[model samples]
Target: MKKKGIFVISLDLELIWGVFDKVDYKEKSSYFKNTREVIPEILDLFSEYNIECTWATVGMLFNSTWEEWKSNFPENFPEYQNEGLSAYAYGESIMSPETEFYCFAKEIIEKINATPSQEIGTHTYSHYYCLEPGQDLQSFEVDLKKSIEMARAMNIELKSLVFPRNQFNSEYLKVCKKLGIENVRSNPTDWFWQDTQKDSLKDKIFRTGDAYLGPINKSYSISSLKAEKDKPLAQKASRLLRPYSNNKILNKLKIDRIKSEMTYAARNEEIYHLWWHPHNFGSNPQENLKDLQVLLEHYKRCHKEFGFQSLNMDGVNKQFQNILRN
Candidate 1:
């Protein structure tokens, strides 16, 4: 049973907190709004296809109002060299948590809570950047504590964490382990895909090309995770489910690459972990959903042929733990 192919999907469910340092809120309002709108449909697709996913949401998103957010803010914050990178001084002016403000997502969270086949995981209390220079482990612990508190307030148990921007610090896993995080989504093994604070231009080009070509395939075998004993279950991500594009030929090729990888993993009884943010589908939800359907249909065929099974990060780790215990 453990040798069967495993399919895992994890979503970095940060609407704007994940991109505040990069994108302007006003310009991307529609993009965020569309993201909020399509989450239900995504959940529906998952339910329809028997797929389970872990949504590593920013803990700040649990606030119903700006005042609630301020009240629940973590005591210590990540001390980034750039002040703008820290989200502590926000919410004093231009506050709007009612209609999908930049960071708040109480309503969206409620939707997720009501959905089935989902695991609620933390993306840190403030989208904490682990690999950043100014952040300390103690501060991260504070953030994770706040995350646990916020999720507890919502009657949610967070057992998995996907680091913000894939900035994984090996030392931080102890903090997560102490806080009961059973697993974390690590980046692929290759240097090009290593977790870094600053992605170089060459890295970006390689990643972009890898989406359409098999430059560095991210898929891995289930045995790959069994090797990590001390750290949180390192469920490495196979590939990022990039957003749909207008270019027909390029899109087809990208989907083809993903399908090929998925087929390979299924046939080999390995694990294919695909992840993305809900906002990636914000611009063209329909088109993105269409492509997602193609992947799901492929997964269905793989399941029928090779005993592939869909599991969230938590489920995968649980299965591995059971296997180890036996």
Candidate 2:
């Protein structure tokens, strides 16, 4: 008997909530507009290829109106050291009907909830940043409560999570476990890939180079998945299906590197997890979707050749539990 390789894709589904701090929403309005437009296409492609996925959606996206969003705001909201990082302030100060493209996505969330082989996971109530300064377990619990409440309003019971900004801490994980999240998408097992607070120039350079070259390992063993003895299943992400860029040579190398790693995981029956934000597809969506098609095609060939299986984050946890039981 052969152990089966598992493939999982988790999308950080945030509209304006994810990137409001990074760019001017007015200037990049078209980028977000394009993001909203292409989501159905992305889902259609996933369905066509029979891919199962997890959507770690921001809790704010569950709101149908500004009033509902206000009503559900967590009482113990984050007070980031940088006051500007607060999504609450951003929501109050800048939000308007015209800006709804970035602020709201209840329709998209409903579509994902109804889709087969898809799980709705939480990305916190306000795209909460855990590793950032002035954040703690108490505030996080309130955020989690609001997140759960918002999902409950939509008739969704979220169990899987991917921290906003990939921030993770032991106390944070404890909070997640307490709040009913059974599994989470953790960063790669690499030592250099620590939480956001420790990020530096050297780390950024290595991550960029690793995208093109094949030095660092991304595939993980079945035993590695069992490291969390009694905690939320830490399903480590293997690679990011990076968005397309202008440099043709660099882009080709990146995609090739991903395919090579995927092949290794399939051959060895390890896990390969790929992730990215939906807004990444916003700019130059045509090329981004095209690159996605190439990966899906490769996945098809891998399934035929090596018996690789597709799973969402929830499915990954369930699969690992069954593996441990046997």
In angstroms, the error of model 1 at 297 is 0.8
TM-score of each: 0.95, 0.96
* Residue 46 C-alpha lDDT in model 1: 91
Best by TM-score: 2
For residues 231-318, what per-residue lDDT tens digits would candidate 2 score against the true structure?
6878888887788988999989988888888888999898899999888998899999999998999999999999999999888878
Please identify model 1 stretches exceeding 4 Å from their true place.
96-100, 215-217, 227-230
**Candidate 1 clash pair list:** none
Score residue 146 of candidate 2 by CA lDDT.
90
lDDT of 1 by residue, 55-133 (tens): 9999888887777877886777788777777766544544765434667888778777788878999999888888887
Worst 10 residues of 1 by lDDT: 91-100
For residue 44, model 1's alpha carbon misses the true position, in angstroms, by 0.7
TM for candidate 1 is 0.95
